[model samples]
Target: MSADTVAAPRLSLNVRYNRNVQENSGEEEESQVEILEDEEHHADLRPQRARPHTQNNPAANNRRCFKATAVALGGFYLLMLAGLFIRFTLLQTRYDQLSNNNSQLQDEVKKLKDRTEVFKSCPHGWTGFGHSWYFKSEEKKNWYDSRADCQQRGADLVVINNKEEQEFVSELSKDGESWIGLWYEWTQGGWKWEWVDGSLLTEKFWAAGLPHYNGYYAACCIQQGKWTQGYYSDNKNWICEKMII
Candidate 1:
């Protein structure tokens, strides 16, 4: 109705409209801020879901490491077992060789003992000359000269004490006459043997028919095997007997 009344009404209407627009704009901005905050929260929660699987990767890595370590330990144990097997094989081979050597040594000792027994059981004869049971001199000499040589060396002309000894000596003599200790004793009026140590002959071991003393020509001695007959003047091989000390 009046100008002032009209101006006051228009001002009131404008104030009411600005207030309403400010209130509505403030409400819309608050809603947009709430929505943005909710969206950020949801984004953070999505990453957390993936974080659980990412954390499990370290545990898987730890399990794989444990498996690798276990495999290494097993390999080491196998290597140790292989080394022990090799050592055992070597020791077994050495032991076998030593056992064989010991057996061989025992056999050799037994053979030596048997040979020694055979020598000890041999009959009383010239056993100290050489390895051979009987031996003949290489050179020839008369009976008296041969007896003198044998006597100087603590030996005597081979004397056959029994048939066993005669057979053994006869095989060693050459196919010729040899000098022995048998001789004719003019004072005794019988055939006598010039025994070692100047002892008289009590036991006689002659052939079937021997010591006839035909012209006192043949001079010989009884060896292990046979009667060796040689001329007194002729030089011939002789056998000497030596006692084993």
Candidate 2:
């Protein structure tokens, strides 16, 4: 009541202390805006570092394309086992050249079948059928009875003319049979062949129908058919003549 009421109480206590300081600054700016919105919501919940794993990824390029297709299938199975070892060494060198050409064609077919069986048992220049000369026989003979008593010794009984004179009369009849010249006479009527220098019957190596005179008998001469086809009474196997020196 005396100096203005003591300065109105000290300005009303300084206006209530500036209104409490502006209401504590406004509650500290609203707690700093809720702490900046919780630090932007924890920076959007974390975790991001995983992107560094690359290798151009599509599952790491499909595991490097399956290890380059298993090394190109092991180099194509080692080139098919070296082409089956060069086709089994060219089939064992063509089976040893066809077994040496079949053993040289079986030794040339066994020497051409032994020269065709020695030209079918002797045969070359044989003659008879006429009259050369005398060839008679009455034996005390024994050289195969003087060669079958010379077939009664006559005109055309021994004539195997070739294979080198039938191996030279089978080596001179080996141990027996001899007298050889040839005879047979009775002329013109039919049986005629004499050759021992007297020459007559022109040259007839008969085999077919031979000196036929069946009944009249004088069939003197001509023998050797145990393998060529000729016969008179069958037994005499002679005839290996050769004269032209």
Candidate 3:
């Protein structure tokens, strides 16, 4: 009876020890599965490392775009200012050329006028009538003295060639009486009027019914568009005439 009882207790103890070892093994397996789950969750929650902060951030992208746009606009502004400066330089050069051309044209026109204008061709103090030049002397002188004065001046008394020339003298003699190149001389046909240059008096402008040969010699003097006979020694204003040289 004592050997059987001892063997039976030892068997019970072995069974209990084996049961406890199996429970501990199960608990360790469960803990290992929990640890694996926690590791997977941590891996999913961690931030990615491939992309940097600048690509995902909105403020950073906007600042980069603003910098690019500012650079582009500033370049355009500088280009426009350079183009304006170039255009202004070209316009200024063109204006200077035009001014030079205008000045040269003005000088040429003045030279042309000086060469072509007949009125300006006459000497000072002389008046041009048609193609002839005339000068009036304010000092009174006799006919012979007037003729000598005209000869000394390289001219002669005004010779009225036509109605136009007669009018010219009439207007010129408006202020006072003046001697013309005409005189009466004793001829074979009695007395006749003649010019100082030995030209015939075919065209005459004698005032109404007057050639009154009261004296032996006669000369012509003009006064206010009228002609009167006077002595060769009569003192009167004189007119001198010559062709334009």
Instruction: Identify the candidate with maximal TM-score.
Output: 3
Model 1 ranges off by over 4 Å: 1-135, 186-209, 214-228
- Per-candidate count of clashing residue pairs (backbone under 3 Å): 7, 22, 0
Poorest lDDT segment (10 consecutive residues) of candidate 1: 126-135
Deviation from native of the Cα of residue 245 in model 2, angstroms: 29
lDDT to native, each model: 0.64, 0.45, 0.76
TM-score ranking of the models: 3, 1, 2
Worst 10 residues of 2 by lDDT: 128-137
Q: What is the TM-score of each predicted model, taking all chains together?
A: 0.38, 0.23, 0.48
Give the number of the best model, judged by lDDT.
3
TM-score, predicted candidate 2 vs. hidden true structure: 0.23
**Residue 154 in candidate 2 has what lDDT?**
34
For residue 239, what is the lDDT in candidate 3?
Answer: 85
Angstrom error of the Cα, residue 23, model 1: value is 99
